[model samples]
Target: MTSLPKTMHAVAATGSVPLDDERALLDVELPLPELRPRDVLVEVAAVSVNPVDVKTRGRRAADAPPFVLGYDAAGTVVAVGSEVSLFAPGDEVFHAGVITRQGTNAEFHAVDERLVGRKPSTLSMAEAAAMPLTTITAWESLFDRFGLRADSTGTLLALAGAGGVGSILTQLARQLTGVTVITTASRPETQDWSRRMGAHHVVDHHGDLAASVLELAPGGVDRVFTPSTTGRVPLFAEIVRPFGSIVAIDEDPDMDLRVLKGKSIAWLWESMFTRGVYETPDMVGQHDLLNAAADLFDDGTLVTTLTHEISGLDAAGLREAHAIVASGRSIGKVVVAR
Candidate 1:
């Protein structure tokens, strides 16, 4: 009989360096994980690359020891921990992992059953790998931050960038809410992609974003959404109508907040990792939300946002995937197969 192939392929950094530097990421072997008491072992068939993965690998430190890098995965389970009852060995699952430890950039990875969701039956592994992170961010931002009712028809203005999360956000807001969507993209390619994802209107984020928006919304947009850095925060004061809200997942840059003082507008931040990192009481909300997204996808109310496919589960493949994101040219998620 033939023996099984070794379950040891992994991607990692060999030394501290910038991602643009040559030899920044390297291939290596890692001992396959021994399932923890509450872990479910996933035989990674396909994994997707996100900006977070690139950020973690390029800038995160691991002392002298090497650390594995990856965040989103779609695969089948091969084993389960003693306490895991939600999954079986044959179950196909998907998850975007917690950032405190090593992630899914390997042949096999173990995750707590609480964080993993059954893969949407209607989507392929390459497509399914794109949902978790961006979905959570957009969902939480829509409901938690802007207070945009799922059934509201008020206008939403997405300022700056039209990549993965923005693409998914446009679709969900259009389908699930009473929101008229306008998105900002600096380039023609991004503008076209946003429109394809269902943005009702597209404008350039460069030049005068606020003036451009006001021209359309003399009364101002009901809400403003930003997926890019906080440097653009001040623009919200002029574009959002009085009492409207601005929601962001990007850094809170040094900008004057006094611009919105007269309007009573509020600013909100969405960080998807907050619950898992703090072990919040509602930590399981992530699992529930992702499962809901899966159901929506299977039932045909939603769609996956995969933009590119990079073959191989090795470092070179992963590096190429990372470069796509780092280049700021990626339209959506980039997936790699095992």
Candidate 2:
């Protein structure tokens, strides 16, 4: 085995302060991550900022240890644990790590092999990094939560169509199913981006959302996928068909469930980390989905949503990427790469 460094460069959230505060995220040196039986140590080449990172940063306790805050990563494996059989040293892999574990904002990361997948042959590390988290979330929302299939025909209304999760959801739903995809975007660029991602209809979310959707999908939509604006569950209830379903990824503590009771509408939540965090029997399903997505990427059936790229893996670059994601208007994924 090759000798590895004792410590590595990393960026961590040192305090629960605003993004502008220098103490919010800091450059630090941490010991190389310890590997478990199912783990593999990766030399991280790139990472992408997501809304979770911004949320996690603000919610870190005052006295807690500095928390690394990246979920999406693409890197090369440098070593594997005793029971690991999925990958070997020098293999390129990508994954959206579980929230319960340490994050991937470091020169090296240790991740469970069941949660990782082979990096797409056709994509650069940055592009590959931009995908895993959003792809898994979107995949689970459409197929696992809503039970959408290639032959199933219905209209799906995806709120915030140009955001990271929405971007990939649109592509997956359009290319893999017979359903009509209706996505919401307020800006011209975002509207165009939504169409390019395979949305059949792009409605202005700034206008009357229900009216705009009803215009395109009369009789209400069959499914609603909300990555943001989850507080509008009542509005979704009014716009979804009887026996329809709604899946949300954002946190909505005050969301009332009674609104959908009359129509028997199903309300579902898709958390991609649930399996990995709990060590569920189907945890390896992520590996299968990611490998499937990689094939789609290689065959040109799907494309990376990365729109902004920052050079370097230091705290300054991560802060910039986090700021972009926190702005809530970033068109696609913003990545920080080596």
Candidate 3:
């Protein structure tokens, strides 16, 4: 094992005490891990702020110091465990870690080799930082949960297409196969960007979402991806072909699911942590899926959707990131440099 660094820095929310001031992220020195055989320690280069981090901060009533929150990391490996053979000390890599552990806001992080993938050679660390969490979500929803054939020629309806996961999914569906991809974005800029990202058609998500989608894909879509919190997007079953699939990442259960019984729609809820949480048989799917994404990136088939960049992993910067996302209309991903 490599000698553990004596001290490292991370943006932390200290104390369980609740106050408006608690939102300020503080720099704190933390001890790096004593490496294990199968683990690799990465020197984080860039990180992205997701909605999960904001939710985590608000949930803590106390000054809960030491809560280092971040999920997505694009960085370079600096040390490896004895059993690790996939990467050496100089490889660039990325991964979105489980929700339970300390996150990627730190200058350094340790991850199991099984959970990480080589960064896309086509992208910089900032661009690669935007891919993992959202891409993992999109990949798992489209491929794993829906079981859509890699070569499926069906139409896919992406709800809130301008958001993080939807932006990536829209392009992935476009670049990977012959799927007729349609996405919803309310703003003018978002609509244009979604089209640029390869959505065959773009519609307003504000009005009756199903009706707007029906306008472009009147023939009926084969897949529905609920990437954002759209209570109405679940009605996509109405626009989807009978027996078509609905893959949802929305945690909110406000939809009238009772309407789907007649269509016999295949509804699936995708969570990237299912395998790591349950130790499922195909837990390594994340590793494989990310590698597949890297390949598409390298081949020029896929594009990076990094729209916004912020500096430092501090609470102020995180607040801005969350505000943009909470407004329900951000195109692509927002990254924060270490």
Which of the two, 1 or 3, has more TM-score?
Answer: 1
Candidate 2 matches the true fold with a TM-score of 0.99
Clashing residue pairs found in predicted model 1 = 152-178, 153-178
lDDT of 3 at 9: 83
Off by over 4 Å in 2: none
Give the whole-model CA lDDT for all candidates, comma-separated. Answer: 0.81, 0.94, 0.79
Could you tell me the lDDT of residue 307 within candidate 3?
89
Spell out the clash pairs found in candidate 2. none
Each prediction's number of clashing residue pairs: 2, 0, 9
- Candidate 3 lDDT tens digits, 203-290: 8867776777677777678888875645654466578888888887765666677677788887789877676667577766777888
Candidate 1 lDDT over 1-338, as tens digits, reads 23334567888765567666545777778777877776888888888888877766766554646788777899998888998888988899998877875788888888777778889999998899888888888888987777667678878987643687888888889888878899988778888888888888898877687788888788999888776755665667777889998887776657777888889998787888888777788877888888989999999888888879888888778878888888977787789887
Query: What are the per-residue Cα lDDT tens digits for candidate 2 across 1-338?
Result: 67999999999897687789988999999999999999999999999999999999988887778988799999999999999999999999999899998899999999999999999999999999999999999999999999999998989999999999999999999999999999999999999999999999999988999999988878999999997745697898889999999998886788898999998999898999999989999999999999999999999999999999999999999999989999888998999999
Ranking by lDDT: 2, 1, 3
Q: Report the lDDT of model 3 for residue 311.
A: 82
